[model samples]
Target: MVISPPEKPTRDEKQSAGRNVAIVALFAALGGMLYGYDTGIISGALPKMSAQWGIDHTRQEIVTAAILAGAVIGALVGGSLSKRLGRRKTIFIIACVFAVGVVACALAVDAWMMTFCRLFLGLAVGACSQIVPTYIAELAPPQRRGAMVTFFNIAIGVGIFLANLVSVVAAAGDSPEASSNWRWMIGIAVFPALVLAAAMLQLPETPRWLIENGTVGKARVVLRWMRPNRTAAVEETLQIWAISQQEDKESRGGWANLTQRWARPALIAGLGIAAFTQLSGLEMMIYYSHTILGTAAGFDAGLVVWSGLGIAAVYLIFTAVGERLVDVVGRRRLMLTLIPGSTVFLFGFGLMFVLTDHPNRYLTLALMLAYMACNAAGLQAVGWLLGSELYPLSIRDRATSLHAVALWGSNLVLTLTALSTIDGLGLGPAFVMYAGFNLLSFVFVYFAVPETKGHSLEDIEQSLRDGTFLPLRGNIASRIGLPDNRITTGAAAD
Candidate 1:
């Protein structure tokens, strides 16, 4: 018997399916928010906790970097859990873990206890970062997948912005107990975690994953729910099953298989992209933005709050812009452009600090915003999207696990190193080191990374197998080979 390809949906049918996909993507985006809130909350809370806990710089680094270390463990284990428990179920479990971690941190009696609790919180954050975008990508139709996944970053920025706003307000109140204010900061995460856990019950499992696990009938049911009135649901389910089965025949889905011929290059590229993105020192800016602003620029707490908010706003806007254009501009081009641009900004930032005894404060702020904007446009928006798309379905789970581990590992090292580097070497030297990393990243992307903007997972897999990089093109569809009818015409349509 010949298996037919899935038929393309009609205009009305596409619209109907798109609406449902949007709703589910929004729900998944909440996971992104939790990841951002958990990570960014410490930025504001750290100062208050320092005075209350009487911790030194070294101890402070340990407290802040604990989550990143836990994230490495979480990312390593999260894939196996997703395979056993299902993606939606695993995410719900992670939400519970996040809530528990929040409570532990909020109620901690000492710095050591808070450090231990942060490891648990990092585990949840790490898992969500791996699972949420993959869930969104698998459920979304090819046409809108980029936009759907990009929502993760936007949600993350919103979470960071909210965390900062909350910190500013909490600190401003000058509670009778300043130590207690930090507790509120950590505890605020619990409300969102509980809400996300409850909200997930309404979501269906990925039809593709259901089919992969030998539940074709259940997969069909899920596809129907996701695509409601479309007759294409059955056909889409079958095609996904076929691709998954082909992948299964090639290798077992594990770390061992990740080294096989078909998987290795993609694994390297994915991990490299993830690592380089973190090594750009973006998180250093994020987790220590308050301190950097106050010390480097000699800004006060109020100025730090305002400047941080401004940076967050720039990230949000540029991330949205990048997400909208990712399909159009292609991933390689964006990275090629943004990485170098970021390096230049970092160089300028360091130089500004060194050259003038007291540099023009306004110029420094403008340069900082430029750095944030350029980062959001490229590394922040594109990193996860490319990482998710680079691997074949057979090893996607394991590959993403590895990628997440590398990302957080680099994050942990950078976070820990930044404290010592900033304190001992000074802010200028610390930033110069990051600037050097970005320069190396530009060369890596130019030589090793391929354009994956318009291509399907199968196409990307085939390209990797053949050692072919899809040529950069003016129109997006040319790179991915989407049928003209399937392409959205403009940014407005997207």
Candidate 2:
């Protein structure tokens, strides 16, 4: 006698599962908003805080770079912390730290106190940068992974927008009392921290993490909830279990696994992309655009602060656009399409700065906006997304922490040196240097980064093991359907 397999989940059931997974991803993405808000708030607050505290350029740089320093340390320790404590718990700890750190910053009595608190706050920011996309990527199906993982990017844009809006609103007062309003800007982030902590209670541990820890039954249940149907969930569970066992036999985990021959490509791609995301000058602008515009471009202080609002608006808008484009055009194609525009726009921006002490303000604004649009849509959007997807599941936590370290460490160097560099080399030359970085980024991505869109985590790991992970002339691997792009029987597209 032959027996038919259990019936697949119905269409309604599939829809329900997808909706549930989306909700979970959205909640997790809130951590990114906290990261953005805390980091972006300083851009507007710095001018006021500097005035209020009677600080010099060196002190201001210290205050700004403090959080980045802590973020580097957070990324350094986060891999071990997340691996031992689990992703969900690590995020909860991040939320708590975010709350406490913000509160401490609000109450800081001096520049030194604020620097310490920002450093403390950066622990959450760094850890969130490492974990949120990783968590979302693990839960999302390959078909939906690009868009879903980018939700973290979208949330960060939202947070930056909110920080800028708050700054603009606070500056609208412009009274003697308004000098202290930076405290309010730094303090208001606590509510989002609270929200993220509460959301963690309802989210499940990732199926991959559970499988690695030998909780295969719970992993299957999570996959059932996260995937479209029971059959797909069961198949994925088996795949993850098999990979976990094979990896166990292959090497010891930790720094050792990352040094393996197979991991070399992912290391270069992930860490190189991470460094370029900063070296390309996005973070430098985000943190110090107001200063660059007001001091270097000779814009009015009010217009400079207001430009932060506009810059953030463009970032949010294009990041949302990139969310759709990444999945539709694929990761490699999207970046290649947008990055050249960034290089060109930045060079033009530098030319404007070189033209005169007082170049055309409107032209400068136009170039800055155009550069932001291209960078936000391309490299900035892809950097974190690639870090989350490139490594094998066995070493993903460690690899992502390294990715975050490269990102935050580069950010730290840029933050500390931006003012000094602009002062010494002239703003035009500094930006021209950034334009060169963008050009170099294009070369690196074209040669090193492979197409990862629409490929399952297990399929990517298999490619690495088989030494087939490199990109072809036009990503023929994806076009030829080498990866597991097919849906399981009775399972709907996620």
Candidate 3:
């Protein structure tokens, strides 16, 4: 006897399809929180630790930048490791590493010890930065992919905000707290690290990754959790399986695979966006916000830490704005607006420093808040979209690894030299330098970064291969493809 097929899902059932995905995105984004927390905690902890450890500004740079160094190493190998170990397992392992690193940092007696501890923390942060976006993309519905991925970055801002708040609270204490408060500030990350570790035990691997590993049954199971209808899930699984099979046939996934002519432009686009994102000084601003406030604005530690709270608040808010606006406004348009707008604010941020009179502390405050808001809305917001999407599926893991390496390496150079640059050229000149980078970033985005706002994965990859994808000038990507939200089972309009 023949069996009847499962009926199409009702509209409410379709709406409910994303429940599991929403839960998954929440947990996945928590790993991003660990990344944000680990990196962000240092902004507050560094000043206090520097004083207690008796390290000068130069030593602080070494200590502060060491994590970026470790992150670079982590990004370099993370892709290979994720492929071998599976994304779920790799992220679980990263969580464990983050816990150990934060605790070690808390216990450190000197800059050398803390710097070494931070290296491990950085490794976890770097790996999460590379893998989380890819993982999220694989799980998210096509129509809402940008919003889902942006969730991870928003979590990063939350981590930064929490870090700044911790600093403000610590600064309110008396003498003993001032000297060793860095320990409490840095050590708090351990809780979230552990939370993510626990969360991962319940999470499944992405359907794409599972399919790639010859576990089609497992892929189906995961897809059921991600899509609204079993019919849709089956369809999506088949689509993902087809892409995986084709990609595997096309490339073996290593440095050698990355050299293919078709792959090169996508690789360059991803890497260029990554490099430009970091070089625009977001890392420098993030890793050194409190320090910049102190040095450039001449705020005392109390004032600096308090001001940081404002910066962090604005960052969290605007990143959320960017998150909501990404799919609505289109990736390239948002970038076009954000990058150029940020340049104006960057110049304003620098101009305030140019005059030594400190004539208007309120104006300085306004300029900084504006700069932070715009940067969060712009560069910091959209930087990951290109890295997450531009590469071909066959080489995505390795390509993203390389992209992450470019990101952290650029981060390392900026963080490692930022203070020195300030020392050598002074604050006004340093801000001006960063502004120039943002100006340069505007040029790059205008000409290179394509709009992938509504394109399917297949169309996006094909466009990149055909070289029609770059320099996107409209809402829709140039393509011929299936209906929108191709991965979801919900009726195209249901």
| lDDT of model 2 at position 300 | 86
Model 1, range 63-150, lDDT digits (tens) per residue?
A: 9999999999999889889877888998899889989999899998889999999998899989988988888888876656778898
TM-score quality measure for candidate 1: 0.91
- RMSD of every candidate to native, in Å, equals 4.9, 3.5, 4.2
Candidate 2 segments exceeding 4 Å error: 1-8, 176-178, 251-253, 472-494
Error of 3 at 260 (Å): 1.3
Most lDDT-accurate candidate:
2
Model 2 lDDT per residue over 260-325, tens place: 898788889899999999999987898898888987888987888789999999999999999988
In candidate 3, which residue pairs get closer than 3 Å at backbone N, Cα or C atoms, i.e. clash? Answer: none
* CA error at residue 192 for candidate 3, angstroms: 1.1
208-250, model 3: which lDDT tens digit per residue?
Answer: 7888899999999887877877887898889878778778767
Model 2, residue 80: what's the lDDT? 79
Q: How do the predictions measure up, each by TM-score?
A: 0.91, 0.94, 0.92
Question: What is the Cα-based lDDT of residue 458 in candidate 1?
Answer: 55
TM-score of predicted model 2? 0.94
